[model samples]
Target: MEEKLKKIQQDFLNKTKDTKTLAQLDELFIALFGKNGQLDELSKQFKDVPKDELKKVGPLFNQIKQQLEISINEKRGTIRKQIYQSLQNEKFEIPSERTGRKEKKGHLHPVTQFEEDIVKLFEKLGFVQTDAPQIDTDYNNFEVLNIPENHPARDLWDTFYIDTTNYKLQTNKLLLRTHTSNAQIRILKNNKPPIRVMTLGRCFRYENADARHEHTFEQFEIVYVDKDVSMTHLQYLSEYFFKSILGKGIQARLRPKYYPFVEPGVGVDASCAFCKGKGCKVCAGTGWLELAGAGMIHPGVLTRGGIDPDQYSGIAWGVGIERMTMLKYGIEDLRSLKSGDLKFLGRF
Candidate 1:
């Protein structure tokens, strides 16, 4: 056994000097030092030899195998580095040439961009962000917001109703919330006077799809209730919001309109940003685009929300996110805004 071990070590050393390449060295290593190789078979022979001699030979055999594996791994790493460097320097052109692949970077959807811009603008004006469940009850969605079953404003939102039987506290309904305005009732119930809140989320309507309308759309709404909050406050905020979003040169006008939730309701319009208020195709030659629906909070609406209308005058507005993004970015079709097309979205 002693003579065989000496001979194996001598043979390994002799082979190492003549090894001209890394591959030849690897082949030699497997034959001499690998699991099925001579060094492994010699170590196993210790079990048949005397126990006293086995202990001394076992460690020495393992040490030799470890040293050889370490040396071979180091050479393999050096060889790999050399091959990589050669490939980097050598350029063979023509056949099957590699072309640069274009990478598509993802971005926020345009509706999201519109929502974010509006949130930032309102946040600057002291409105705290708030949210409500997408599925809401009739109380918060309509009744508490001053839209009774018989009221015309309920018509303003084509509601998607849900099963009322599955609920314990329910009598007859649930709905896919039609507007962020529902957050107002929720906000007031959870908060007290001097409440200022804004919310942006999905809203549903049962309208036909067209260049300008969608059955499903995004809505942003703001509610401010405090002592002495009035239409003037509403007007100033509206003007500032449009100017801040559309730029410094924009102008807006308000005309009388009606909603069940707001008395002295107004339809707000902005001078066409694309045409500078001179009649143009974007504005449909109307010189103004309907921008928002806003009004002073009605007495009944305030009373229902656990607030006194006499003591607290308030104003609220709902802006269509689809219209805002489309108008701001010159998007011609409302459908394109939601189309999931890379060509359309990549621009923003």
Candidate 2:
């Protein structure tokens, strides 16, 4: 057994010197030290050997393994350095043959470009950018927004409910917020009025995804509350936003719409950019596209936020960022905004 172990050690030490690459070293390791390998089989044979020879065999086997490991690691380091050097010395070579002109660089993603443009426009209007947690309590997302638990607006169950094992209630009540408007409520509660805030973020819903609808989407909310604010202020801001986003040729119209948090809500519509309000496939031949939902703050919402409705008024508007992005860029599908495909995104 001692003679066999000596022969094995000599063979390994002599053979490994020829290993020029890490892969060759790896093969040697597996052949000798790996499971079901030569070294493992030798160790297993110890049970059949005389008891007095067991101690010597175990230590010899360990010494061989340790030496092999040291050599393998050292060779691996050298091989890695050589490979890195080769890579560093490599160069890109252009073809010698003539080629056609490459295509022009693609445009920005419509959503990202439009989002920046709108945020810049609103910044100029003195609306500071604000954000809220995507995961929110029912109070901040609902009750504080004047959509109490049992309100008809709660029927808007399209929201994503989060596991609330951590909450005191220990119920499935926390959620992925459904709209950026929830930020308005948060702003009101944390900051005293004379607040003009805008939020941009993702909102999740349980709705079916389509060309015009996405289960996850983006919306921007503009909330302004101060002394004696009115519908005229809301209209002016709405018109300015539409004109800024869609260009001077476009016009915006406000039509009555209802929302739980806003009294006498209005749907802000912009004249279709495509066909310029005459009629087109972009606007579904309506000559108008619903752009945003906006209205004056309801008294209940004001009271809930510690603001006196009689003493202060606020305007809140929720704009579908995807919708606006699609309109400005003539994008037909809302899903395009969410899809990360470079082919679709690069056309912005």
Candidate 3:
């Protein structure tokens, strides 16, 4: 039994010294120290040995196990050091230092470009550009706009409300403005009539995004307030702006619709340029693409804005900037605008 133990020790030492990698070291450990391995079989044989000899065999087995563990750890460290040194000796070219290729110049985002173009077009029509807060009071966002608490039109906007119990306007709710139309009442409250204001900004809604919709999106609204403002002016403005942005020969029509803030609202639709109003998938086979909502400002809304609706009538229209971008660029998915995909955006 003593001679057999000496043979096992010598064989383990010989195999471990020849191990060149961690994999081989692991295999050696399993063969000698694992369950049902050589060491386990040898330990079992101790039961058959005389009790006086058992003490001598037990100490020798422990000594071999400890030495094997120390040797494996030292070998693993040496292998790691050698591998790291080999990697350090390898040559690699730094990307920024490479020559002969022109650096790509960055450009404005497609949405910003669209906004600028739209602003320019509206400016030419005597509309003054303005902006509004993304976070606004519930009064300006809903109440001031004639959207009462129980009104069904309130359901149209999936609002993101903020806790205002600690705020100065504790009695009022705070929320992400659902539309740029909120700017209309705000502008009217601050400025008197004969206002030709065009506002473009981001709006939010608690909505699931799809090809045509997004929770966060850009909206553009133009509000014109003056005596004798009528549906005729609304139609003319919509057609002119649509033609200016969508290019020549485009036709726009207004179909009767309803909005709480806008009395006798009309749905604005433009003939699909893709199929020339003959009907196609781009227009969902309707031949006319629904564009925006426009109407004379409601008396209740005007009264909330401190304007005399009986003497002064106003026209206002709100359009989705992303929707316009989709039509202008022929993009199928609204998600592409907010995707952060350089390849998709670079096309514009």
Overall local distance difference test of candidate 1: 0.81
Report the lDDT tens digits of candidate 1 across residue range 1-348.
666776887787667656657889889888887887988788778779787877777777777767767766776776778788989999976433345555556889888888888988888878899888888877778887667788754663576777667668635777888888888877776778898899888888778888778888888888899999989988998888888888777778899998767878999898876777778766788888897999998888888788998899888898888888877887878899888888978898
Q: Which runs in model 1 stand beyond 4 Å of their true positions?
A: 1-99, 152-157, 164-169, 274-285
For all candidates in order, the CA lDDT equals 0.81, 0.82, 0.84
**Number of the top-ranking candidate, with TM-score as the measure:** 2
Error (Å) of candidate 3 at residue 113 is 0.9
Report the Cα lDDT for residue 292, model 1.
94
**lDDT, candidate 2, 97-149, per-residue tens:** 54554555667667778788989998997889989989887877887777867
lDDT of model 3 at position 291? 76
How many residue pairs clash in each candidate at the backbone level?
Answer: 0, 0, 0
Off by over 4 Å in 2: 1-108, 148-152, 163-172, 278-284
Query: By TM-score, how accurate is candidate 3?
Result: 0.68
Each prediction's TM-score against the native? 0.68, 0.73, 0.68
